[model samples]
Target: MSSKALEQFLDENIEDLKSRGLYNEIDIVEGANGPTIQIGGRELINLSSNNYLGLATNNTLKQVANEAVASHGVGAGAVRTINGTLDLHKELERKIAAFKGTEAAISYQSGFNCNMAAISAVMDRNDAILSDELNHASIIDGCRLSKAKIIRVNHSDMDDLRKKAKEAVESGQYNKVMVITDGVFSMDGDIAKLPEIVEIAEEFDLITYVDDAHGSGVLGNGAGTVKHFGLQDKVDFQIGTLSKAIGVVGGYVAGKKNLIDWLKVASRPFLFSTAVTPADAAASAKAIDMLMESNELVQLLWENADYLKAGLKDKGFDIGNSETPITPVIIGDEQLTQKFSKRLFESGVYAKSIVFPTVPRGTGRVRNMPTAAHTKEMLDQAIATYEKIGKEMGMI
Candidate 1:
């Protein structure tokens, strides 16, 4: 029989979440996660995917993925430290390094793994990490794993960061100090103040790390946030994901040559975990090549985002300040947010509600992602659906 105590714990917590409207129910996409998706035999104008450039369904990427599978079989077969490092992996890393304007780079199985591996590799118990309170969950876990003195810095508050940085260094309580933040916060869609962050890091001699998971392929002509700010050489570690804009599965750290060398030797995930599939590596490289070749997709993405934002605002719906394409339709109440999302789905839109504890309790929202693949007609329909739902619910 199952352990009664463990079963009780699971049952109680789940029930509490469900009653509070804090539990998230996931929806399955029937086919390609492109501009639109099919669920429950209905097509939805998808506004909840991280596939910013829509490269996930690109014909060229699909072709490359198939070719890689035919040439290299499926899996990488071993951890990167062993025999798993294929020629495709090398080519992908080389492409990433060049794309990010870094001296070298190293790839991991996912963006989460990149943080889990890289953070603990360079930092330890005696060090301290000043992390933005609003950083992704992966970054939080990675910093925790390092056993560092985790100092919470206010979200994009330069003064708070500087004060914390000063205290951390002057106290002489740690061997080394690092300041970490997301390049673009996914929840509210605001860009981080990187120039100020870099300035403070320089003053304190703190190591800098930016997880640009949401910013890549959507900024800096598709290079990333570091390049967007022209601080490519100033940042110590630039973290990115292949699954999002690159439209594949993997993550990487691009930095100085020595840092990449150290991570390749020291990062536990690279040493213990099998590399991403050969197809993933090849397809990712091909996507990067496409981004470097053209700015068409990036421009299209912004245009769609602007149109959606304007439509929502005109309907009197509150879309919080978003400097990037990741838009949040702030609904204020958890139940209301979920209801709003449900109404959207029924109207053939597929945006999802984000509630506590992913975001603060009272700031629940339905996050919208406008992709490059969406045509003007698709966006217009989505906007009209939003307006209808807002009027029905008295939210506008």
Candidate 2:
């Protein structure tokens, strides 16, 4: 293509994004994403990270990573199926399988890649996938890549799921049927009705896939959503991320040994992309070990979430129906929501606005992620900032 044509295309896309107020201007963080982060030389109370158990900066994990780096160097050098399957990678997979109560597990470069790999590996154009409407974008992409007929069921609406699943199976047009959902919807912080989903899947013989990216470190006393609901054996795929609660980097799918074996040979990312670093793998193993050792961090995280949610609710902010630590202070208009976030940042709070297409338009809001590392005083400060900005912007 000509340079002018390419430039025109880029300009038009940028203009479209600007027109929709969905263009995200990157903000550089000068320090680690802790309870307080330094951005633009200003310290802000950070509430937009997925570090639920606060392990991202934990000293123990840091030490583990350092040790692994010293021993194995930084990069894996090749793909896992190539010469990249380090002992650290195997160890991390073993640890993850144990943590998730699965026979085996397979790691990928990212949680997003896990979805991209697993979904397409199992389903295809001859299959049909019943996905929750509010599932993560990665899941949507995965389904699309699978070439499967995508059926979007209402979020947590079992009736719609059941109807769709039954119709798809009864038609006999599909060779396989799968149901995919986010264990905890990141946008709403609502837990998936896994028990109901499992029951439905069993009745219809539908394959179950749960992307527990948000629930892995925050739920099941850190065992994850499958264990939380006692559906470990029932769920076919338990997808999780090391970058979230684990405070490292990478993603994995925990399931039957045969499923993992198939993925090792079939998943495109595993076959074509390089493996995760030894340091990240080692640190993630250590993080899982910590979560299994005690509930102190998980409990503390819940307490912090409760405290922040209660304070926001008391202040008359429409803190949406969040059963987990992920909370959203709902503000309708996109521009107003962005302004609200900007004002919060100015006041030393780091909550970010969620707008289309990360979320539906007109449901724009600031999403808060309270971690175990946050003190009550810190939450109080955030609450005070919210109150001030909320009233000033007429959001409350």
Candidate 3:
């Protein structure tokens, strides 16, 4: 822990990352990550934000937050197990449960924390988890933390999931088995075959968990992926984020009352960490209310996504098979993908490159996240820029 050793450690690791081209140079956004964002005093069409429905900057959400801040102050003051469970927090949880059509729901600081809190609370060393090979990092961490025997199921391959579930169940080595997957894969925009997963879970008497963080406010009339597939009653755990399409902060787990009650009492984060701020809770509730009141924003988001996808395909960019709005213009080379993203940024589009470690080697891509807030003109301009740069770089 000496200063010299710490410096040596930092220097050695950073240099190693740089040499491997895995060191990411952070970009400071001068303003909001809305349809358009500002960086270095220059504005660009932001195709990289997860603000799918554009509610992050909605005026109604802002007004609700302003009022909550004025009445409740900023911090939650204590952890939920103590006094941090404010009326606003309870209302937010209630609203989310209602939104998700679940008996109860519990909120957490982040989507990452939600996985950590929920998984470790339910599964332990005696239990086993059948997780998608492409599940999020948080899910992996949560599974690991639970001391569960983790089984990897091939991505979206129902047979693999079924095989793993059967194997884990038949082995009788673990007390319980849980099947977990991301409702929508962020990298590929592929939707999980949840109906098959649910069937597999039922056949093996396995617990079903869907992390619908990206699907909420974007699918199933803005309810989520499970709802999109009409398996809300069958899925045991439905996890979602108040961030992303809801356009705020925090995460939640929605399910049967008993499961939620268990989480409230057993989840470490809920018991130890301070709750989300009053402003955040109120704003998130308002956002959910908005999502329920109208599908105008969701409709716009899909329209934009479709428009962008069609435009890109026409221009000969290999946008991988994505069912959601997460469009990945596959470049197949890390350096070229980065250069492509840089060129787009220079031409007023803000998209980032996804390279190795984040993705498999030689499958690098520029991921574009189009929002409902974007205008047709903006999409047109972005497409034009893509065509220009793509050909200039001999990419198409």
Candidate 4:
């Protein structure tokens, strides 16, 4: 109520974060976050970016974005339902639908907004949502916003999912039921069991939603997890991001034409917020085209991941069971994990430490994102740095 009271409350929270070693101090990257970056005036081999396919600073995407800015003049002045639906937006949506092999698609300002828009647009107070325990924060928030009865299944625990889904359907306590999960668990890099989930969804008549934010441009030869598991038609809502592997900015929901149509009319973000800029839309279209054209970048990314994982494992670091390009060096204590990341940064590497409430407290880790742009030499340097730091910190 009072200024001092509010200030004290904020102070306590800040102290708590520092005490838990979970307080993150943002660092400014001097240039592009490519395979290498300049932070605090020091160049380091960067493993902290979501630029999986190395398309963030790509020349072709840059040129396309530049041209769009020249033509569209920077921003979409109004929301999609208003005056912001440019031809570029439509073209990007069409390309995304084709890439995801879906009937239609709708774009949002960010991947995070896509979750908020899609989930809340479909499921509401009268419905129930069965979500994965380890799904992204955006998914968690989206579920909360929907006012749905949230049932969190154990991470990748199909049996738990099946049991809950059966009970939810049999109870008939909800007007509708939906099951949502990330196509690839971000922290651990493990893929969702879509085949099993799809089977269970069919049995329970639950709507299937897969947020393939990390899986797009990385799985199914860059088509996404739905296509990777051949469940393209089975998954009711296939969500993806243009920000991650697509190497741009924006999010989308690819599904039946009716679903996209409904979202266009009902989703709050689509109706209230300005659409993605023409540059983002154009660049994203080109990124999708790149993924569709060849698997060279994807293959290279996997190879780099394998090399880094193997190297870290050989160095006696507990690299978790990651099936994708995301590799986590598990250091149980939050402070130790933070120290590890700092030391690595100081020694010319740029992987960041992830701690609760991002993950379980005891599972703090330095997550490495190996990209297609990383070379064998770059990874070797990172591995060597890890070994040095791990040994010095008695982590090995």
The whole-model lDDT of each prediction reads 0.95, 0.94, 0.93, 0.94
User: Which ranges in model 3 have alpha carbons more than 4 Å from their true place?
Assistant: none
Error of 3 at 91 (Å): 0.8
* TM-scores for the candidates: 0.99, 0.98, 0.98, 0.99
- How would you encode candidate 1's per-residue C-alpha lDDT over 1-396 as one tens digit per residue? 999999999999999999999988878889899999999889999999999999999999999999999999999999988799999999999999999999999999999999999999999999999999999999999999999999999999999999999999999999999999999999999999999999999999999999999999999998989999999999999999999999998999999999999999999999999999999999999999989889899999999999989988888888999999998999989999999999999989999999999998899999999999999899899989999999899987
Provide the clash count, candidate 3.
0
lDDT of 1 at 312: 83
- Candidate 3 local lDDT, residue 364: 91
What are the runs in model 4 whose C-alpha is more than 4 Å off? none
- How large an RMSD does model 2 have? 1.1
List, residue by residue over 231-320, the lDDT tens digit for candidate 4.
999999999999999998999999999999999988998999988889999999999988888999999999998999999999999988
Tens-digit lDDT string for candidate 3 (1-396): 569988999999999877766677789999677899999889999999999999889888889999999999999999998899999999999999999999999999999999999999999999999999889999999999999999988889988888878888998899999999999999999999998888888899999999999899999999999999999899999999988998999999999999999999999999999999999999999999988899999999999999999999999999999999999999987778888998999999989998888888899999999989999999999999999999999988
| Model 3 pairs in collision | none
Shift of residue 9 alpha carbon in model 4, Å: 0.8
> RMSD in Å for candidate 4, one decimal?
1.0
Ranked by lDDT, the better of candidates 2 and 3 is 2
Better of 3 and 4 by lDDT: 4
Question: Residue 25 in candidate 3 has what lDDT?
Answer: 76
